[model samples]
Every structure is written in structure tokens, then in C-alpha cells.
Target: QGTLKYSFNAKDKSAEKTYQCEVDRPDPTDFSINCVGERTKLAIDIDRNLGKSKVYIDLNRFAGERFGFEAVRDPQTKQLD
Candidate 1:
């Protein structure tokens, strides 16, 4: 796990939030992705054939200047297509 640290301030109020980010160790069994440039598409092929699962893209995960990502999924399958 890693620590996420940041600070915030306002004219009349100030706040700080510190959270823990658990590093995701790659698991080839279920989830996989195809990435090109700044975009990433995730596909999960589960054993149960659950049709297709959808994943939401969080912009904050690619907050740094050196990297970025956006989610593109099919409307029918709701999986990255």
C-alpha cells in the first residue's frame, strides 16, 4: 500500500486529506487491458462467462503530467470495445 497525501485551503477554511492507495498487483487470470498513447481499455474474460462487466474510469488515477487515461467501452457490452 502507498500513501496519498495532499492539502487544501480556503479563505475561511482549510482541510487536508491523507489516504492509502493499495497497489494493484497484476493478475492475468481475469483482468487485462490494451493501452495506446494516453488511452486505456480494460477487458475481463471471466471463467463464468458473466457476459461483460463495465468499469468506470477515474481521472484522478492518471493525475500526473507524465501519464493519463480515458475509458472507452461499448454501449452494448459495456466493456471496452
Candidate 2:
């Protein structure tokens, strides 16, 4: 478990908020984390072998978006990027 915090401005006023968080790792190669509070939510998925990853965030009061990434290791050099 953890905490998620953020600050934002609306109409020239700044405010900060915090959320309770939880993380889960069902396997050694893959895992996920989630944080939620009020009307906001944040989630993430990761692969240990440099395969794929995803992230999503929503703050209810604003726009939300999701991102995806994929990576492969070089067989000869054993490097990932």
C-alpha cells in the first residue's frame, strides 16, 4: 500500500489531494498497481522481462488518458530499450 498525491490549478487556485493506494504482484514476471480516492483513479501494469507496460489515470474533474509501451531485448547484446 502507498499514497498518491497531486496538485492542480483551476481558475488560478491551486489545490492538493492525496489518495490511498494498493499494489499487487500475482506473478514474478508481471504486476499491477492501483490507487483510488474520491472520484480519481490511477492504474498501472508492468512486465519484468521488458515486454509491455500500460498506465491510466483519471481525475474525474479533468480529462483522462491511457498510455501503452512495448520493449524488446536485443538477443546479442542482452540490452533493452
Candidate 3:
């Protein structure tokens, strides 16, 4: 359980948002995480692709955040670029 308190807009009105997240096994073979919040939820899963070696992320449907793509992981070094 996690609690986050902040103002939603410039009105300075206080608000409290709570969330709960649980992770069972997050290893090389399998990874899963479940998160729930006031009006949003996120489910992340990482698994090997048997047919293709590709990795993708949810941008429109599942993910509602529009965080700019100014930062990315270097494909070769696996570091933040």
C-alpha cells in the first residue's frame, strides 16, 4: 500500500491518492507486477518472445502518460541514453 498526497492543479487543493502493488516473481524467466490506483491501473509483464526477439511497450491503450521520449535505453549497452 502506498499513499501519495498532492495538488491536482493550480488551485492548490489538497488530495490524497492511494495505490497497491504486488509482485510475485520478477526474474529472467518470468516477471509480473500488478498496480491499482484511484482511476488508473498498470500491469507489466516481461517474458521471452519465442517467435521474435522484440520488446514493446504500451503507449496509447494501457499507458495514459505522455512522458516525452527524451530518454531511452541504449540498445547495445543497456544503459539510459
Candidate 4:
């Protein structure tokens, strides 16, 4: 298992807040990934040469008020995986 720590600053009309969270990496087949953010968004990366491999993210149901993903990568090389 792998863990990732993220932090971001978010502001609305009234105020601003800094948020942080630690999220565990999801399974390779589980393309539906999410980030906890006030204004949430999804980020997916895929290696076309790696067969049908792809990444999917859905950030509509996050817990935190602000969040983001730094990066996501498989343990093996791009060619191997």
C-alpha cells in the first residue's frame, strides 16, 4: 500500500482556508478516484503504449474542503506496466 499527503489553499467569497489530507492509492482497475476539495475536480493520466491501462478520477464526493493530486504512477517501469 502507498500513502500520499497533499495540501492546498482554497478561498470563497468570504474567507480562505488551507487544507491537508493523506489518501491511499487505489487499485489499478479502480479508475474512479477522488480528492477531498471544496471545488473538486478529477485528474486522470494514461499511458497509451501500456495496452488498455488508464487512470480515472471523480472528485464529487470528497471529505475535505480543499485537495489535489501531486501524481500517480505504477511501481514498475512504463514499459513493464
The order of the candidates by lDDT, greatest first, is: 2, 3, 4, 1
- Local lDDT at 24 for model 3: 50
Q: At residue 75, give the lDDT of candidate 4.
A: 48
TM-scores for the candidates: 0.28, 0.55, 0.37, 0.23
Measured with C-alpha atoms, the lDDT of residue 3 in candidate 1 is 50
Candidate 3 per-residue lDDT, tens place, 36-59, comes to 666665455544322112222334
Off by over 4 Å in 1: 10-14, 27-70, 73-81
Q: Count clashes in each candidate, considering only residues at least 3 apart in sequence or on different chains.
A: 0, 0, 0, 1
Residue 66's lDDT within candidate 2 is 41
Compose the digit string of candidate 1's lDDT tens values, residues 1-81: 545444556433346554444434355434433322223222223321333444333334465324333345565666764
lDDT of 2 by residue, 11-71 (tens): 4434767778998998898898888877778778887666666777776667654444556
| Candidate number that wins on lDDT, 3 or 4 | 3
75 Cα displacement, candidate 4 (Å): 22
Better of 1 and 4 by TM-score: 1
**Residue clash pairs of candidate 2:** none
Model 2: lDDT equals 0.73
Candidate lDDT (C-alpha), each: 0.40, 0.73, 0.48, 0.40
Which pairs of residues have clashing backbones in candidate 4? 38-65
Judged by lDDT relative to the true structure, which candidate is superior, 2 or 3? 2
* Residue pairs whose backbone atoms clash in candidate 3: none
As for TM-score, the candidate ahead, 2 or 3, is 2
